[model samples]
Target chain A: MADVIKTATRDAYGKALVELGGINDKVVVLDADLAAATKTGMFKKAFPERFFDSGIAEGNMMGVAAGLATTGYTVFASTFAMFAAGRAYEQVRNSIAYPNLNVKIGATHAGISVGEDGASHQCCEDIALMRAIPNMVIINPADDVEARAAVLAAAEYVGPVYMRFGRLAVPRIFDEDYKFEWGKAVVLSEGADVTICATGLMVKEAIEAKELLAAEGISAEIINVHTIKPLDKETILASAAKTGAIVTAEEHSIIGGLGSAVAEAVCESGKGVPVVRLGVNDEFGRSGPAVELLHIYGLDAQNIVAKAKQAISLK
Target chain B: MDAVIRKQLKIKACKARMGIIEGVFNAKSGHPGGSLSCADILTYLYFNHMNVDPQNPKDENRDRFVLSKGHAAPALYSVLALRGYFPVEELKTLRKSDSMLQGHPSVKYTPGVDMSTGSLGQGISAACGMALGAKLGGKSFRVFTVLGDGEIQEGQVWEAAMYASAKGLDNLVAVVDNNGLQIDGKISEVNSPYPIPEKFRAFGWNVIEIDAHSFDEIDAAFNAAAEFKGKPSVIIANSVKGKGVSFMEDQVSWHGSAPNAEQYEQAMSELQQALAELEA
Candidate 1:
C-alpha cells in the first residue's frame, strides 16, 4: 500500500483528454456545465478553442456531440453519470448510437461511491442503460492507468462509447506500461477455488478480497472486467469453467452492471456454474462518506471474500 | 425575385410534393402534412442554395442540412431524390423496412441526409455542432436545420438556441416551420412557442420571419441568414400545415396521417396542375 500511488479515474480522464487532444487535433470536448466537476475543464484550459460547454443541458450536449461527429471530429461529451446516462439516455441512443457516431461519453462520478451527493447523483444503472443501446461500447475503468488507456482506445475506435470514471481516488492497480483492451477482461490473479470478478472501484477491492480469501485458505481467481458490454465472453466463460464457482463485484446495482453481464454470459454458454453477485441490492444510496457507502453497500473486499465463499458453497 | 427562377422552383416544389404524396401513400404510414409544408423550402435549399454534390454525399466541405422535424423525412427524401442523390422512383419505399429512407432522417443510411433526427428537439443541437465543427476547422461549409413550431416547447431546443449563440455559431441557420399545428392541435393551443422571432433574438440570433411557401421570401430569408455574421440566425417560416394539396392544407388531421388512394390521387393531381400552370 505504501508503494502504490492512488489517483482518481476522473483525473486520469481529464488528463487523457488533454493528451489525446494534442495528439489528434480533431478531438473535440463538450461539457454540460459540469466542466469543473467532470474535470473536462482541464481540457478547456489547455485548448480553449476546442472545448464548448452546452450549459447544463445534458440532452443538448449529447445531440451536439452527435452533430460534431458527422464532421471529421471525434467528440467527447462529459458530465455526471446520472445526467449523461440517466437524463440524456434517449439523446445518446437516438442522436449518437443510432447514427453510430464517433462520440465518446465520458461519464464521471459514477456509482454510490459518488458519496455525499446522495441517491440523485449516484448512477448505479448507467451500465445497464448504455448496454441496452445498440452500437454503444461500455467501458468502466478499474483504475487511473486503465482509465487513461480507455480514453485513447475509445477515441481511436470509431463509434459511440460510454466510459465511466470514479470520483474516489483508488490504489493504482496497473503501471503506465499496461495496455487497455476493448471488450476484453483482464484476469488479475488466477486460482481454482472461486472466480472473483469486479469492475471500476471494486476491481482493487477484489484483489484485496483475493488476499483475504488466501488467508482463509480459499484461492480466489481475481478478474478485472474493464469493458462491461460485449462482455469478453471468452475470458469470462473460460474463467467460470475453470473455477466452477463465480462471484461478481461492482460499485453499481447488482441488477444490471458487471454482475448481470457475467451471469448472462455464463448462463448463455450452457456452463452451469453458481454465481453470487455482490452490489447494492435494489436500493438507493444515501449521503455518506465515500468509503462508508462502499462498505455499507457491500462493495468492499470483505464482502467480495464473503460472496466468493458463498459461490463456492453453492457450487 | 426572378420570375423564371421562381417558376422553375415551383415546378421542382410541385414534383417534391408529388413525391411526398407518393411516398406516404405507398408506405401507408408517414407524416405528409409537415413534409408538404416544408417542400418549398427544401426545394429552395437543395436546388438553389446548398453547395452539395450528389456524387459526393459525404463531402466534408459541402453545406449540411439536418431536418429537426424529422417526421418530415418524406420531404427531405423527396428533395434529395429531386437533387439526384437517389432515384425519384425510390420515394415509394420511404418508410418500408428495406428502404434507406427511414421513419426519421438517418444520417448513416440515407445518401444526402446530413444528420439523423427523429426525437424532437435534437436536430438543432446537432446543427449547432456542425456549425461549431466548421468553425473549429476554419472551414466555409454552413449548417441548416428545420424545426417544428411545436417542437420548440422542448427545453432542449432553447438550450441549443442559447448554446449556438454562446458559441457564436454564425455559420448555422435554423428554421422553425411555424405551420401552427403539431400532432395534437394548433401550436397556439398546444403550448405556444409563438413570438418565435423575439425568442431567437433574445438568444442572440439574427432573426428573420418569412412565408415558408413563398419562394421569394424563402430565398431572401436564407440569403440574409447566409450573409449575417458574428451570430447564429433563426428564420421563423410561417406556413400552412399541409401546403400545395388543397384538401390537406391547414388541416390538422393530415398532420401525421398518410392519405388513402383517392386522397393521394387528388393531391398528386393538384400538384401536377400546379406544375403545369407554372410551366405555362
Candidate 2:
C-alpha cells in the first residue's frame, strides 16, 4: 500500500499565507510572537515587509488587524486559539466583528489535540465564542488541501473570518485538486442507518469509524463540516432526514461546536432524529500525547463507532 | 498660530461645546464632562489640523481619527456636524433608536468616523494598526486617537503603546485627554495612570505635553508629532472635565449624567453666552 499522506493544518495555513502574499499585495500577516508556532513564519520569510510581530499581545494584534482592514488591507492575524478566542474575545468582538472588518483570524493549536501544553493552551469553546459574535465566519478545515483552500477563500471574502487550525499531523482526506466551497459541507459517503457529522481532525477519524461501522453491517453516511458558522444546514438536515439518526464528532467541546450546530439545525427543522454528540465534554484537557489525549477525551474513531451504535439504537 | 485662526478656533470650539450640551441634554443620557473637556482638542483637529474633506469623508488618503474614549461621542458628533460631515440637527437624535449617531463612535453608521470605538483600550491599538497600514502602503495619511485619562487603566493600552513604538509608526499620534475625572471619581483616586508622558516615553514614543484647551499649544504639538520621524507620538493634553459650563466644570457628578431640564437650560445658556463672547 502507498504510504498515507499526512500534514498538519497549521503547515497548510502557513504555506497558503505565503501564496496570498505573492498574489495579493494587500495581504498582510500579523502574529503575536508566535510565527514559529502558528507557522506564519513562512509568510514572514516570504514577505518580511508585510509581516508584523505584535509581541505577546494578542489583543493588540487583533485591534491592529481591525485597524489595517479599515485602510483597505486584508489582514490575517495568526495566534494560538486560546489567545485569539479566549484572551482577546472582546477585541475580536468589538474591534473586528462590530465593524465587520476584513480581518481573518488564523487560530492554530485549537482543541484537546494541543497536547502537553494542557488545558491552558487548548481552546475547546472557540467555535461557541466565535459563533456568538456577529459577522464572524468560522471555518475548521479537515485536511491539508481544504485548509489551504479555506485560507485563500477567506482572503477573497471581505469580512471577519475565524479559521481554526490544529497542531496534530492528521492524514490527508481530500485530493490535491479538492476545491473548498465557502459555507458548504462535503458529503464523503452515503448510508441509510446513521449520519456521522464530523469536523477538523475528527473528519479523518469519522472516515475510519465508517469502516468500523461497515464491518458490523451498519451503513453510516459521513459528512465533513469545515465551515461551522454559516454551517451548511441544507446538507446536514438532508442527511439527518435520510438517516433518521445522526452522530456529530469533533476534537472540541460538544456543547457549542459541530455537535451543537447539527443538533440545533436538526431540532429547528423538526427532523426529530436522535443526534449523538461525540466530543470533549465540559471538562479541561490534560497533559499527554496528542493522539492519546484525543482518545482520552473520547474524540477518536472507536468512540464514534460506539456513538454511532448509540445513535442507531436511539433511532 | 495666527491671531485670526485662533479667534476662529475659539468660536468653533464654543459652538462644538454648545453642540455637546445640546446632544447630551436632548438624549437625556450621554457623557458630557469628558466630551466637553476634549471639545477644544477635537475642534483643533477638525477645523485646523486634519487633512479631511467633509465632501469626501471616505477619501482613501484622508487623515484618520479614532475616538478611543468613545463615550465622548457627543463631542465627536458635534465636531462632525460643525465640519459639515452631517447635519447639526442630527445631534438631537443621539442615543435614540434609528439614530446613526450612537452613544459611542461607530465607524459604520457615522460619516467621517475613521474607526469604530467604544470598548476602551482597543481604539488606540486600532489607530496604531491604521498607522501601520499607511506606512506599508507608502501613503502619507496620518492617524490620530484620543484616549481618556481614566481609560489608560486598561492593560491593553500598554500593549498598544508597546506595539505602536516598536513598529516605529511615525504617522500615529495618540492624545491622552487628561481630564482628571471619571464616572466614579478623580482618575488619581479611581486608578492613576499618572505621569502619562513617562509611560509613552518608556514605550519609545515621542512624548509631548500640553494644555488641552490651548489651540496654540495643540497646534504646535500636532505639528511636532507630524515632523518627528522614526517613532509614534503621544500628546498628554491636560484638560478640565466639563470645561465650558461653570456648573459642570471639574464636577465629577456630571461625568456620565445628563442634565435635567433646568440644568440643560442653564448649561446651554452658559455655552451660548460663551459663544457670544467669542464672536464679540
Candidate 3:
C-alpha cells in the first residue's frame, strides 16, 4: 500500500470515475463544460461516445442527466458546486431526486477552495441545499481514498447522490488499503475526552487537532464522517455516549451542514451531547488562498482544538 | 377510427374529466383549470393513441407519457385510474398521504406513472431521453410528453427541445397544451410564449396546430406526427384553461384552485350532458 498522505478528494473522484467507466459500459458522464475544472476530462478523453458536454447550461445538463438516468444508464453529472447544487437545484430536486434515478452528481470546487473565482463560485451552502432534498445521498469524502470509495459506492448504490469534492489538494490522509463505505463513519482514533466529528477537508483538520490535543493531555476522538446524509448514526451515538461531548467541523456553513446533520442524528437518538459546530458563521467567503479561507472561516485545526476544548470543558 | 372506439374515447374523456373534478374537489387542492383543459388530450393519448397496457404498466416497450405541466396531474390520474392502472376508488386518494396520486405525477407511488414530475420544463427532457433510449435499444416504442404553453417559459424546455431536434428524435412527440393561463395570470401577461408552433418549428421540429379539445384534430395530429420521419414533432393544441365547465371555463383562477361542492356538481352535470350527447 502507498504511504497515506492527504490528497484532494476531487482528484480521487476523477480517477475513480474513469475506473468505474472502464468496467461499467452503462456508466456515462455529462459535464456542464467544466470537464477540466471538475476533473472529468480524463473520462471524456477515454469515452468520447459516452461523454456529453452541454456547454455551461447547468440546468439543462441536470435535466439531461435525469433523462439519461431514466433510460437505465448510470449518469454522473459533473459541474462546479455552485452550478451543480445551486444553479440546477430545482432540476436535482424534481427531475432526479423525485424519481430516485441512478444519477451521481459530482460537484467540485466546493467551499472557499475555489479561490479567485470569488463568492459566486465558492459554494459553502451546497451541503445544506442537497441535504434538504429527500432521497439524496450527500457524501463529502475526507480525502482522495475516500473519494474513490465514494464514487464506487455511488455506482453500486442505486439512487440519486450528491458527491462533493474540493479542488485544492491537501495532505493525503488515507492509505491505499483504506476502504470506502457509504453512510458509515470511520473512527480514525478514539478518545474519551470529546468526539471531533468532521467531514470533507475538515477531517484532515480534526486529525491534526487530535494530534495537537494529545500533547495537551486532552484525549479527543477523531471521526471522519464522509457521508453527510444517512449519517453514521451508530458511530455518532456511540462516540457521543463514550465522550459525552462532540464538535463537528466542515468547510461549509455552520447552518444545515455537517454540524446540523450530526445534530439531527444525535437529537433523534436522544443523546444529550453538547456539540460545537465549527464552520463559516453565516458569511460569504472572500477571494483568497485555500488555507487563508480555512483559517478565516474558523475551520482550521486550531479552531477545532479550541472548540473541542470548549465543548469538553462544559462536560 | 372505429365509431365504437371513438365513442369509447369520448366516454373515457368524460370519465377522466369527472375524475379530475371529483379528485380535485375532494382534495380541495389541484390545478383544475389546466387539468380540465388537457383532459381531452390525455384521454386521447391514454385510450386511443398509446400502446400502454394497464396490466403491464412497466412494460419495457410501453409507450412513455410525461406530463411536463405537472399541475395537470388530476387529469392524468383520472385517465390512468379509469384505464385501470388502479382502482377508480383510488381517485379519492389524490394528494392524500399514502396515496399513489400525489399533487404531481409520482412514478414511485403511481402504478402507471413513467416519470415523476412537478417542476415545469423537465419531463420533456426525460421523454427525449426515453426516445433516445428506444432508438438505442432498437425498439419501436414512441414517447409522448405534454407541456403547458405557460410552462415553456422555463428555458430548460427549449434546451430539451433543441436536444430532441438535434438528435432527430422521430419517436418523440410533444404536445403543447396552449392554455394561456399561468399561476398569477395569463401566460401572455406573465411571459408570453406567443407563436408556439412557429417556435417549435424553428427549433427543428415538425409542427402541427389543432383544437386540443377536438378528438378529430388530436387524432389527425397524432397520425400525422406518427407518419412523419427523421425529425421530432410538436402538436400545439389550442385549449382553454377550463374547457368543459361553464363557470370555470377560461378562468385563470382555476389553475390550481379546486372547485367547491356546488361548482363540482355543476361541472359534473355539464360533463354528463356532453357524455350523453356523445353516447347518443
Task: Put down candidate 2 lDDT per residue, B1-280, tens digits, no spaces.
Answer: 9999999999999999889988998899999999999999999999999999999999999999999999999999999999999999999999998999999999889999988998899999999999998999999999999999999999999999999888889899999999898888988888888888888898899999999999999999999999999999999999999999999989999889999999999988988888888888
Q: Candidate 3 residues A119-170, lDDT tens each?
A: 9888999999999999999999888877898899899999999999998987
Residues B1-280 of candidate 3 have per-residue lDDT tens digits of 6778778888898889889888998898988999989999999999888999999988888999999989899999999988899999899888998887899998889999988888888888888778877775678999999999888999999988888887789999999999888888988888798978788889999999999988888999999999999999999999988888888889888887888778888899999998889888
Q: Please give the distance, in angstroms, between residue B111's alpha carbon in candidate 1 and its true position after superposition.
A: 0.4
Candidate 1's residue-wise lDDT over B6-35, tens digit each?
Answer: 999999999999999999999998999999
True contacts kept of each: 0.86, 0.88, 0.58
Candidate with maximal DockQ: 2
What lDDT score is found at residue B202 in candidate 1? 93
What TM-score do all the candidates reach, one by one? 0.99, 0.99, 0.94
The DockQ-based order of candidates, best leading, equals 2, 1, 3
Residue A105 displacement (Å), model 1: 0.8
Model 1 residue B126 distance off true place after TM-score fit, in angstroms = 0.3
DockQ of 1: 0.86
Which ten-residue region of model 3 chain A has the weakest summed lDDT? A2-11
Which candidate's lDDT is highest?
2
Note the DockQ of each predicted structure.
Answer: 0.86, 0.90, 0.59
Candidate 2: stretches off by over 4 Å: none
Docking class of 3: medium
Give the worst 10-residue stretch by lDDT in candidate 1 chain B. B186-195
